[model samples]
Target: MTLTPNEILALPKVVLHDHLDGGLRPSTLIELAAEIGHELPSTDPDELARIFSDNADAGDLVRYLEAFAHTTAVMQSADNLRRIAREAVVDLAADGVIYAELRYAPEQHVAGGLTLQQVVEAVQDGIEDGVSEALEAGHAIRAAAILDAMRHLDRSLEIAQLALDNRGRCCVAFDIAGPELGFPPAHHREAFQLLRENHMPVTIHAGEADGAASVGEALGLGSARRIGHGVRIHEDIDGFGTDEVSYGVIAQHALDQQIPLECCPTSNVQTGAAPSIADHPMHELRDLGFAVTINTDNRLVSGVTMSSEFGVLVEAGWTKEDLFEATLAAAWGAFLPYDERADLAESVIEGYGIDL
Candidate 1:
């Protein structure tokens, strides 16, 4: 009783934590890179695809991030930004994703003489165009940008203000990304505070390369609403043999606080956060009443989709109940406003109606 990737897609799901530049089509990158005179790992499309897949499987965060150089290099222009954003929406729609909060750092795209406002505007224009194209083609799509501040840099507060400035127009949330260890959320406390005062939502990357202490700082210092790859919370669990005692203070707090963990299974495996999807602690975290949502952290990098991700989960022994709960978890944890979030939730449930 196996199902195809398209079958998993038809189940209706929400993507809470996917990156904009990281999900580009390999062919698109090949063309865009050529247009900008950017140095690519290989000129051939198949070679380029291999480069991305290998980097994602490189087993360390720093090595795994080398592939982004090509994506960011070609994405600095208004035309490129708009095209990629439009393609992003169309791609997500094809994968059966109804709503998405795609994130990228505006600072990175400004290298080509365009200002941050121009960058934001370009992305918004492309998103609008893509959604328009999808509807004309009779497909559903809703997308908003989440401006991420690179953790290794010190411009997060600036990025936070930029996201706040574009709140209703294009930006939906502020996220912190980059090397997760050493650079704890405390480093961006100012940005988090700015987001808090402005009532802007914030999601922090934590508990992936680092440990639970880093996740604790993200929660306590950043006041993170949603945690990216909080898989390391498994470190806090004890009594590994029989009746494993995972009821520690932090574990209990996460369950009671109901913070959603953006569990990107394949990316986690690629980045060495988890050995594999089955070895991922998502099952334990979900069973313990924690909100565990599935995601593709980087589609092109990992060579995955929400569809492929679910198929992998099913092959790893996830049942229909598991799929349903994970889908609902992702939809609920989406950064949408209450009404839109509710609409998405209703849409997911209704998708399961009149079974095939």
Candidate 2:
């Protein structure tokens, strides 16, 4: 049975791969851009939103990422960073996100002279503010930060330290983002080693612009607890949908470990990772016993919410049970303590009125 729109919206979601810089509200972008004298493709919110959505559908990873320039341009100041973070939480809560780990590269936001620590603090402050506002509004949401270091840059070790230093304050984990092709996770080995030594959770952005080799390196070398946009793990599977399917080394490793795949269907389609949502590997991966979870990689850039992402899956022939499984997997895969993950899983089961 397909879920009704209201049913979809009422389901609790846990988003682990959302980017703070990619989820800005169009109106907020307009206002912040004007304040910073940053020129945008369009000043009108509706028009600007259309431009971002359309441009990001370029079916190319690098082109899809270019939309962030405008969003990040306004996010340089502490106030702007806080506002964006606050709005992200408020928006997610309104969309029925019970828990979220919003991520952003601290190094990117240092353009306005804010130090890395200051950037983390600003985002954490904003998340706390947003959580308070959501609770007061009767939403009851919890949100935190994931500090990211651009993969192509040389500051992964420093960013790893930053995340470790702010472990409980707001930052929960560390990630390496940015263009993924030439700059594999190996380049950030030192940073990954540091985070590994400190026991900081990691989720590497692999198998998106690259392939299964990138994913293997993420797991084997980077010590990733989760794989970001890991849809391309399908590449390592021979005859993915057939009964005679065979798993390659990386695929076998991921399956053996039950590693969570942070699959973003809409963003993956937009980035040309999959031909379309119907053809996406998420459902098949789920059927394969992979830890598959649904996510909105970027709200504004991909023009998706948790509800809308599920809605698209429904349109593509997914049942409500599929949605429930994905949500439960997300709760289990959250970068939270075991008790907290259990709590989140319980919340999901309660929201769905079902038991796994």
Candidate 3:
């Protein structure tokens, strides 16, 4: 059945792979930049908006990522980080995301002298505040925090420890992000081992800029429970399509492991991972039984939302039922406890008028 963009958005959703820095509101960036005297490419809100547009529309990951330098610059302060997280939750909730797990590299926040613990705790405070506000408005939104260690750096073990320390608190998982190709997950093997020993939930940014080997390494070395943008798994499939398609061992293993692949269509386009929304591997991944779920990797950098991602998928020929399944994939892959994840699945079924 057909569904309009607003209708698609109204169908309750889950966002498993979103970044706190990548989702800031533009006006928030302007205000925080002003308060901190940080020079910007464009101070005017309109110009700033256009700048964001150019970055995303440029279809270049490096250019799109440069925008985060400004955002992270302003967010170095605890108050700014808190406000960004709080506002991000409200925005995600308004977009009908029943649950969200926001990730960011804490080392980036130390520029303003806040300790790693302080940065994580501050974002946690913001998420709690946002969830409370949403609950007050009768929405009952749930939010979790994931600590991301920049892979190019040597702090993975420390960040993993931090997330584990806050595991049952506001924090839910640990991640490794940043440039991927040369800096393999093997670099962070010790950190992943530590997290695995603690039974901590883990997700890794894999297969976006890199290929299947990177994804294999994330699972093999990092022991990632979920793969962030495992789109490159498609590389293993040759001539896949028509009245039939095929899945290689790597792709099939991801399915077998039930490791959710966070497919951010728009962000993939901007990052050169996919040529366009229509070219995304989402359909291929899902059709092959891979746990593929939609996401907004960097909402502000990509200037999109969970709703917008769904809209793009629909525009690319996804059906209402397809969206329902994708939403279920996200809910099922959420880093919540087993009981909580089950509850989310039930809520999603109720929200989407579906079973299972």
Candidate 4:
């Protein structure tokens, strides 16, 4: 049976690559900005939402990142951070996400005199509160945090250590997110090494602003088990379906190793990584046997949800089976332990009533 948007929303989904700051409610931004005496681009909630969505669609990664300044500006306090984190889970649960890993850079929130550990704790408290509320509301959702270090900065090791410190508490993994062109994952080699040595999970932002070399370094040097926005890995493939069709070293390694690509179609198009959702390489990657998963990299900025992302894939010619496959891939690619990951995958399969 073909799945409608409502059916897709009802399916148990796993989200691995959503940003915490980028997913704030517009009303919350207005309220938080007012409390902090910070000026906003727009006072009306609808206008502010439109501004974020429009600014993020500026045709390149650098411009797309500029939109975060507004969101991160108001997220500078403990209470505001807690409220945003809690609300993010509530929103995801309402949208039918069963599991999620919300990522944010603690360093960005320290401008208001909060330490990195304090910022993490605040977000953790918010996540717990949100989860409890969702359970009480009968949503049955779970969430974990992923600490991000700005790739252009020199604090990756510190962030990695922080993630290690909070392994089973709230933080589940470490990531480096920023402009990927000049700041490749190689610059954070020490941080990645630390996470690797400590047996912590790592997912690098690569192949979004840059090309296949970035993805290669993420997999080889950064030791990323999953690639955030690895859309440009398509650059490593040649002559699709032609007699000359072949995988370059990086693409072959990613495919052979089953490395998951957190493919965000709307965000990819907004950042010009893909021409459009219909033209995204996710379909090709899945067809080529890569472990590809769908996500909303930024719900507010990209104006998308997990269900809407699935709808985009469907409009791009994906069937319910393909959506189910992506959900299962996300469950397996989750940073949870093996048994827990397996259980999540089974739950998703049962939710979809599939035999995968």
Q: What is the lDDT of residue 222 in candidate 3?
A: 82
Which residue pairs clash in candidate 1? none
Model 3 regions more than 4 Å off:
242-246
Please give the lDDT score at residue 138 for candidate 3. Answer: 71
- Residue 246 CA error for candidate 3 (Å)? 4.7
Report the Cα lDDT for candidate 1: 0.84
Sorted on TM-score, highest at the top, how do the candidates line up?
2, 4, 3, 1
Give the candidate number with the greatest TM-score: 2
- TM-score (all chains, Cα) for each model: 0.95, 0.98, 0.96, 0.97
lDDT of 2 by residue, 1-356 (tens): 66899988988888888999999999999998998899998999899888888877876656677789889999888899999999999999999999999999999988899999889889999999999999998898888888899998899889999899999877888889988999998898888888888899999999888899999999999999899999999999999988889999999999998899999999999987878988898878989999998889999998889899989999999888888888898888888999999998999899888955
Candidates 3 and 4: which is better by TM-score?
4
21-123 per-residue lDDT for model 4 (tens digits) = 8899989989888987888888898998887788777775566666688889988888999999999999999999999999999999999899999999999
Candidate lDDT (C-alpha), each:
0.84, 0.90, 0.86, 0.90
In model 3, pairs of residues that clash are: none
Error of 2 at 187 (Å): 0.5
Candidate 3 local Cα displacement, residue 167, angstroms: 0.9
- Writing each residue's lDDT as its tens digit, candidate 1 over 192-267 gives 8888888898788999989888777877878888899999887767752236575666666777888889999999
Q: On TM-score, who's better, 2 or 4?
A: 2
Shift of residue 62 alpha carbon in model 1, Å: 4.1
Go through the candidates in order and give the clash count of each.
Answer: 0, 0, 0, 0
Top-scoring candidate (lDDT):
4
Error of 2 at 275 (Å): 0.8
Location of the lowest summed lDDT over 10 successive residues in candidate 2: 58-67
